[model samples]
Target: MQKSITNQNQENIKGIIFMVSAVLILPFSDSIAKWLSSSYTTIQIAWLRFLIQAIILIILSFSLKYKITGFHKKFILVSIYISSSIVFLFWGLKYLPLANNIALFFIEPLVLTLLSVLILKEKLQKNHIIAVIIGLIGTLIIIRPNWSAYGMASIFPIVSAIFYALYLITLRQVSTKTNSKSLQFYIGVISTILLSVIIVVCELLNIDSFGFKQIDFNDWWLILLLGVITTIVQLLVSKAFFYSKASSLASFQYLEIISASILGWLIFKHIPDMLTIIGAIIVISSGLYLISHERKNSKT
Candidate 1:
């Protein structure tokens, strides 16, 4: 019994470490995307990001001797949702501050809770309801809908969060049946194809923001780093989730917000306003409480 408890504790520690590493690494990719957004269209960036990821993942799969499997609807759906989330996030980053974008995206956990209740038919506790409300309030504070300069761009991250939440939900179902590398490879391939289609459509329609442009040498390096780092982060996060309960993993996600804030300050000299800061605190607190509450209920 003691040995079993010790192994469980070790797994929990490993999960926390992996999760923290993933969140830290993820901000770097977003920062690079924000930097590159000035030069490349969102669709173009998304296309390259997924394309490179797919290539690397294919190589990794072959090296590791993991056979590519048949088509699964869940994998395709997860890809679509994640691809949409990335496109929306990069679009928002083009206009919004990194901190603002991260703050808005932080509502994903709350969104996931609601999704669980609705789609998973999970019973919602009173604390979960309260946490969702508080989380929304925090997002609103950061957005400040009427006053923010970004205007409609502010809504993009919220949309990104929604898609990401759905991705997480879909991932939960698919992760059990698929190997992580194969799953990632398939999603990368599907997303690359989807972004390619979007880019072709945008070019045909002459949509300036979505139109493709020739990549420069500097941008090539950045895009490569974006894909590689993002792939690593995804693997780390997948391992983290495998080792820990979703509820326990939820709180550590806020680390991305902190890392984003630092990156924004260093790279862009952007700072959150008083209201945004207050909202972040509230959101973090509420999310932590929600996770702890869930953990307690599970224990009982």
Candidate 2:
């Protein structure tokens, strides 16, 4: 079916756009979260973030009569993995600089790519393999191998990478019949519910980690910004996965490092050293070429 191929090609192109936008914009959200972490507990920040995200998405998805319907049970697992990932990531962000936190988390793309092929049964073409490898090399160069110094903070991101990679894999498996908005809404809702239960349970059990402190109205704006960014990014990521293989989408994640670097320097005055800049250049060049190649092939 020529028409089918054409449709899939268009979807592939859109997928690339959506995935790239998600990765790039997500860093801004991460930057904000890192800044906020100093003033809030990770569980406190995470539960509230998911709540705001759920609220925003529920409003945006109001028109979808069946906004939270028909997803596989696997989505529950997806919610757990993602919530765990976020909790771990926020812990890392609180202790690590924005760029370093993001660099360490970049390992998710590699983990996702591996799971895509080995677990999801997606074909890993030579070019994709090359793209992911190049992306990692660039990421490693940026971090420059001083990971041990970050200590426990660094370990959190690694754990996050595993959870996030599993989250994406599970999401891809369950997104075939699901539209992006509804899927995003479902995740927001489920994740919100999951985190709420966790936070409450921690409180009931006399766990002091996520205790609710006196509220500050001032921080609501930052929380709103995070919700908006996360909601929109999740929409894009859901769309991307709806249109492309998990492995194909992973390479685009490297673009986040560049954004993280710029946002870090601008907001926190954490300048990127020479190696970071060079690594970013390598990542973008290879990523752009891969995108162009995919587009040309799709046209053919």
Candidate 3:
């Protein structure tokens, strides 16, 4: 049992690393999609992204011998989660700056904490409350809310975050009985099917046109990279929750903000202003403390 616990910890650590790396890669993918967003509709970009993800997920599931069936009851909730996530995220990418969009996503952990306390009856530790406060302070720094600077684009990601939190809470409830890979696979598959239906209906109704911009061959590499890397990342994140509490792993998501700010500045020549930087630090620090606290409590 001791050895088993140690092994699980090691796996969780690896999952954390993969998840953080994936979070780092995500901003770049968003940048790419956002660049394409001007010419392409939101559903077009979403379908393309999910189609690629679905293909990669199928291959991985088969190769790893992960079952993709069962868990019928969880499908509706999972579908709602992924569909809402894809649409809102793509739409947010369309209108908001990359850094701003990502910073708002940080709220997801706080949302998860609230859900756990309310729905799951999980008590928040002292550190959990402190972390949340610190994280919120960090968010305020990033948004620096002013009467003059608000826009509808900012609200989309917040809605996305809320939907994502609900998704996480539902996953936490179901994860103990079902396999993590299966959960990830079902999400990808469901999202793919839903997207396909939406694409066909849109085509029929002439609601919007999908522009298949003949790619420059080289860009196809990035698209493939985006698909494969994201699939692997999703699998790793799913597995992470197997060993750690969803609420525990959820807080570490704040690390993505630091990664996004650095990447956004380095690749896009976009720098977060002083307030954003201060907020990022507060969120990151509090989130780290929350994770550590959870780990310590779990051991005791």
> What TM-scores do the predictions have?
0.84, 0.93, 0.85
Candidate 3, residue 14: lDDT: 58
RMSD of 3: 3.2
1-300 in candidate 3: lDDT tens per residue? 877776666655655565556565666667776676776777767666767877776787789877676866776687678678767876887777777887776778889888988887876666666777687778878877653554777777888889888887777677776776667767777777887787787777777654233455666776676566566666666666555555556667777787678877886677888778888878778767865754664464
Which one wins on lDDT?
2
lDDT of the candidates, in the order given: 0.79, 0.84, 0.71
> Mind sharing the TM-score for model 2?
0.93
Which RMSD values do the candidates have, in order? Answer: 3.4, 1.9, 3.2
Which scores better on TM-score, 2 or 3? 2
Write model 2 residue lDDT over 156-222, tens digit each, in one string. 8889989999988988888875776667667777888887787788888877667555557998898
| Residue 7 lDDT, candidate 1, scale 0-100 | 71
Ranking by TM-score, best first?
2, 3, 1
| Candidate 1 wrong stretches, greater than 4 Å | 1-17, 122-143, 243-248, 273-278, 281-300
- Judging by TM-score against the true structure, name the best candidate: 2
Backbone clash pairs for candidate 1 read none
lDDT of 2: 0.84
In Å, residue 27's CA in model 2 sits off its true spot by: 1.1
